[model samples]
Target: MKKLVKLMVFIIALYIFLEINNQWLVVTEHVLESEKIPSSFNNYRITQVTDLHDATFGDNQQKLIEKVRATNPDAIFITGDLIDSNRYDLENSLHAVEAFVKIADVYYVLGNHEVAINKMDEIYIALIELGVHVLPNESLVLERDGERLAIVGIEDPLMGMETEEMLNIALANVPDDMFTLLLSHRPERFDTYVAKDVDLVFSGHAHGGQVRLPFIGGLVAPGQGMFPKYTAGTFTENDTTMVVSRGLGNSIVPYRLFNLPEIVVMELKSK
Candidate 1:
């Protein structure tokens, strides 16, 4: 019995040690094939970074910026949670977004934190000044080679508004023939996007369950309870595909186990 107890303690200690250390920020590349993808836009690269929560990577997010620059994406998408309301760092978050603005066409949507903290107005104004396109429950047309695509961004559902109606109105402008992309904060609400017939969705709020195990996936997420189904990776339903990022920063629990920070690079193909 004593030996078993000692082994358990050792395992626990090792787990904690691993959680605090070795948080390597790795890039996960995904290739998505779609018939709707424009011929001129084939092989278009999109870099997604989410759940920053005011965490700094190197001096003033230099390391993160360098990695993004290396990717040379056609556009950068920030799903949500640029700053944590509970532990706010305005400068770091704004600076990071500012740096990103210079790199690519930055498009963003709010996560729960942005609403909870009541900084959406201020941050939205700031982002606009930096040339970052902040899409709020609307679709924006992206054109290349005379072919057009639609990207829709929605406000997080934490604001106690009618989601189904709001989404219907937001997506009303997108034509049936055009390829569509959605920037939603919550991955758990993927069903909503699928129901709306959106082609692709990008989200980050689960934080990769805050801690993950190999094969087991994520442990727990905010909206989804223990062993949440939509914690990480890609989920496809019908014609819609949802890409959930493990996220680039931490919140609430303040640590990640086996789940390292990541920047998701999605390569869109005209298959």
Candidate 2:
């Protein structure tokens, strides 16, 4: 009887640990430096919130908002998967964005989930109403101290258009030499972003491979399949650098193991 009792206690403890890992939020920071970064924009902070899947962190998303506010980001980038297609909860997801807009300029792009929901119009309208810059195959310029930095966003390829074609149209007007930042949903397209000479890219979708392994890295990802690359962290090739967020919420998997929810806080520096 004592042995059985001890076994039950161990099982309960393990369950609690896993639950905390999934529910708790953690912040990860990275500093990126490049000569292309305009001097005026040095020390520019960008807080990335991705793949939320409509998960809540505290009442009205206060906990999540506070985390971003503490970072003092000049801009908040909502890479994609803000709402899970499975759950399709726009109002719940927007709770975070509403607060984010008041903190800093909010930029967003579509994810596979948004495409699957087929309610893109409704989602776009709602975010735009809340002062969020919904960039769907669009480009805009951020000018400070007489210097220019282009921000380009593309829709997920799941939206019927090829990713490459969408990128071409988006960059048609932007100069080749200008410092450009691309907000994309799929990280598997790193090669395409590099080929286009994009200076930086922010992406999310893997959900940190859903389950991370000890040294083998992420167990699986959406595009890359088993042990997929670009699950999280920064990747650089040529002049292009992509930061992949593990993301904050889950989708079909329904649970996370070892992989805690993460918010990537990136600070840009001019070399």
Candidate 3:
């Protein structure tokens, strides 16, 4: 009985520690050897945030913003799942958008949750109104220091009606000799992008398995299901690279174990 009581106390203490320190901003840097990137565009900083899910950001967000500001990111990208639920609440989404707007030039794509909540239109408009560039199956070119980089955002295939056609259009304008960054919510569609020879893809739909196992990896992932392929972190296929964020908040299940919430900062380097 005494041993049992001691074990229980140990478990409780461990849980508290994980929850309080769950907020971690992971910074990952990668370099792509593409003919398109201008020689001067070698050290571009791209900050990425995914799966906020309307949970309390705690100090993670503020610290992330400060870090990005310090890095002087060339641009910011949010993959999806900004809200935790389908039901729209103005306060939470708005607050998230406002906070990101103050940090850097923001661009976004919708996640499955955004569609499930049936508030994509309103959320899209709200984000744009707040000076965020909403890229729904579209592409934009950023010119700095007389050099150009192609940034493309694709809609979730599950929700967007003309996802395939839109992807074609978005890629049509990308020059053969330019570095291309594709923003997608689901990492499963990597094959499609690889066929098009995209340089890098960013995604966040899997919450790093939600409940990760010690050495076995993620136990469950939404959409992808058990033993999900792209739960969190970085994956590469052929020459195309994908970074799946563990995400910043929880949904469906309110608690997280092993998998802590994260905001990803990726610096693009030239090789």
Candidate 4:
């Protein structure tokens, strides 16, 4: 009987600890090197913000912006789910969005929440006005020195069209000699991006499986069931590298256990 009581107390303590840890924000840094990188863009930093879900770290997301500003990023990439669908509040998210725009060039892709909330048109229009490169099956070119790189964004599959079809359109105009960066919401479609010969891809939506178990990785994710692959970290296939952020917010899972919010920073290095 005493052992049973002690076990119960331990479980309760563990739950409390996990809840507190989930609120803590963290920054993850990585360096991506490739011969394809241009010298002019060497050491170029990119801050990735994903799955905000209307969660504010501080007033108007001032704390979050401060963290990003310290990175001195050349650009900010928002992979998706900037707002929550069930809550359906844009004003809160827009404040963070507005702050992000002031930092650097921002590129965004659509997430499932954006479509589920049914505010796609309104959100896209507002973002476009902010000079954000909100790509929906589209591509944009950034030039450094005499070299150019392609940054493409794909819409979420919930938008009523096949993702592969949209991918074809986005990559159609990319030049053969340029380095390509694809912004996709789902990491599960990594093979599709690899098949297209994309140089690198940034993705979120798995939320690090919401509850990671050390070496076991994420417990479950939306699209990928139990023990889903590609939950976080860098994965390679052929010539493409996919960096999946654990993400900054949660949706299906009420609280993340062992999975904390993180902002991923990538520095491009020339090999």
Candidate 5:
């Protein structure tokens, strides 16, 4: 009887700990240096928020906003999955974006969830009204000290378009010598980004494999399957570097094990 009681207590304790871990926000900072990065843009900080799935972090997303504001980012990027398709709630997710736009220019690209919701027009209009740049297979230039840097964003492949074709369209006019930063929702397409010769990329979709394990990393991801690579952190292939956010919130898998929600703060350095 005592052993059974102890077992119940242990299960309850583990549940509480995992719940806390889920809501506990952690900032992962990365300093990316590349000779291609313009000297004028050096030390430019960017805060990335991904895979929110409409999960609340403090009232009105104050906790997430405060954390991003604390980073003092020059730009804020929302890679994808701001809201969950399973439970559509754009207003709830926008609470963070409302605060984020006030802190810095917010750039966003669609994720699989958003595409599945089939309300791209509504979502785009809402974000645009809030002063967010909604990039749909397009490129925008950020000029600093008369030096040009391209920021390219593409639609999620779920929109019935192949990622390679999308990249080709987005990069059609971008100069070969230009330093390009691509915002893509799927990290599984890292090879495609590298093939396009993109200098840097920001992506999130794996959700840190939904459940992480020590040494083995993310246990499972949507695209990468079991023990997938590109679940989190920085992955480099040749000259292209990709930073994948572990992301915030949960969807189908209601709990995250040993995987704390994360906000990636990246600073660019001209090497």
Candidate 6:
């Protein structure tokens, strides 16, 4: 009995150590069947980082950034939760922004936390200053090697900022031959994007339930109840593909088991 107890203690200690030190980078490549995707864009890479929740400059974040940079993505998308609260250290947000800016073309959308903290404008301005494009009910045409793609960003729906009319207006000028990508903070309203014929949607808000359970998936997600459908990874509705990142950080709950911090790299392919 004594030996068994000692072994169990040793194993527990090791598990904790690994959790602190085990920085993992999960890569997911997605293929969207879009008529607008040019043949030349057979494999355009897009890296996604979401729900950071102020986990910056730490070993996990550093490792995640390094891994993302290594992927050599054509563009990077941050789906929100960049800051935990306006009360927490703003420096962490700066750090997180700087890290991504150094790698690829960074784009972002606001999350509920930003609105909850009532610092959305401040955070938006700061991120824009760092050369990160803040896409809130806005659209930008991405031109690379003579190929044009439309990228749209919508504000947080839960915050009551998302407008279907605004989204349509943003895409009004986009030609039918151009591929469209939408960045939203929540995955709950995927149907709206699908109706608009959006080729891909990237989001992260559930934090993969913050603490995923074994075999059964996530236990609970904020705003979303137990076993949230869009907790982490990919979900498809019609022709639209939605990639919900597990995110790099945590909030309300600080520990992750089974679910590790994720940095998604989606490679867009032409059909």
Ranking by TM-score: 2, 5, 4, 1, 6, 3
lDDT of 5 at 40: 96
Instruction: List model 5 lDDT by residue over 131-237, tens digit each.
Output: 99999999999998899899999999999999999999999889999899899999999999998899999999999998888888999999889899989999999
Please give, for residues 1-271, the per-residue lDDT of candidate 2 as tens digits: 9999999999999989878878888999999999999999999899999999999899988889898899899999999999998988899989999999999999999899998988889999999999999999999999998998999999999888988999998898899888998999999999999999999999999999888888887989998999899999999999999999999999998888889999998898998
Give candidate 2's TM-score.
0.97
Tens digit of per-residue lDDT, candidate 3, span 112-217: 8888878889889889899999998888988877888889998876674655666798888888777889998888776777777788889888888888887777
* Candidate 1 clashes between residue pairs 3 or more apart in a chain or in different chains: none
Per-residue CA lDDT of model 6 for 1-271, tens digit only, reads 9999999999999788657632454666665666668766778889888877777545545666677788888889988888887345556667756888988889999888887887887888888889999987888998767877889988876566455765776678777657888888888777787888788889888888766777778888877788888887788877788988888777777677778778888887777
* Winning candidate number (lDDT): 5
Across 1-271, the per-residue lDDT of candidate 1 in tens digits comes to 9999999999999876864443567889998999999988899999999999888888888888888888889999999999999898878887777889888999999999999999888888988999998988988999998999998899888767655765787789889888998888899988888888889999999999887888889999998999999877899999999999999888777778778888999999997
Shift in Å, residue 121, candidate 2: 0.6
Q: Among all windows of ten consecutive residues in candidate 1, which has the lowest summed lDDT?
A: 16-25
Task: Assess every candidate by TM-score.
Answer: 0.92, 0.97, 0.87, 0.93, 0.97, 0.87
- At residue 256, candidate 5 shows an lDDT of 89
Quantify all predictions' global Cα lDDT against the true fold. Answer: 0.88, 0.92, 0.77, 0.88, 0.93, 0.79
> What's the residue-level lDDT of 148 in candidate 1?
90
lDDT of model 2 at position 111: 96
Candidate 6 weakest lDDT stretch, 10 residues = 17-26
Estimate the overall C-alpha local distance difference test score of candidate 3: 0.77
Each prediction's total of clashing residue pairs, residues at least 3 apart in sequence or on different chains, is 0, 0, 3, 0, 0, 0
Provide the lowest-lDDT 10-residue window in model 2. 17-26
Measured with C-alpha atoms, the lDDT of residue 263 in candidate 5 is 98
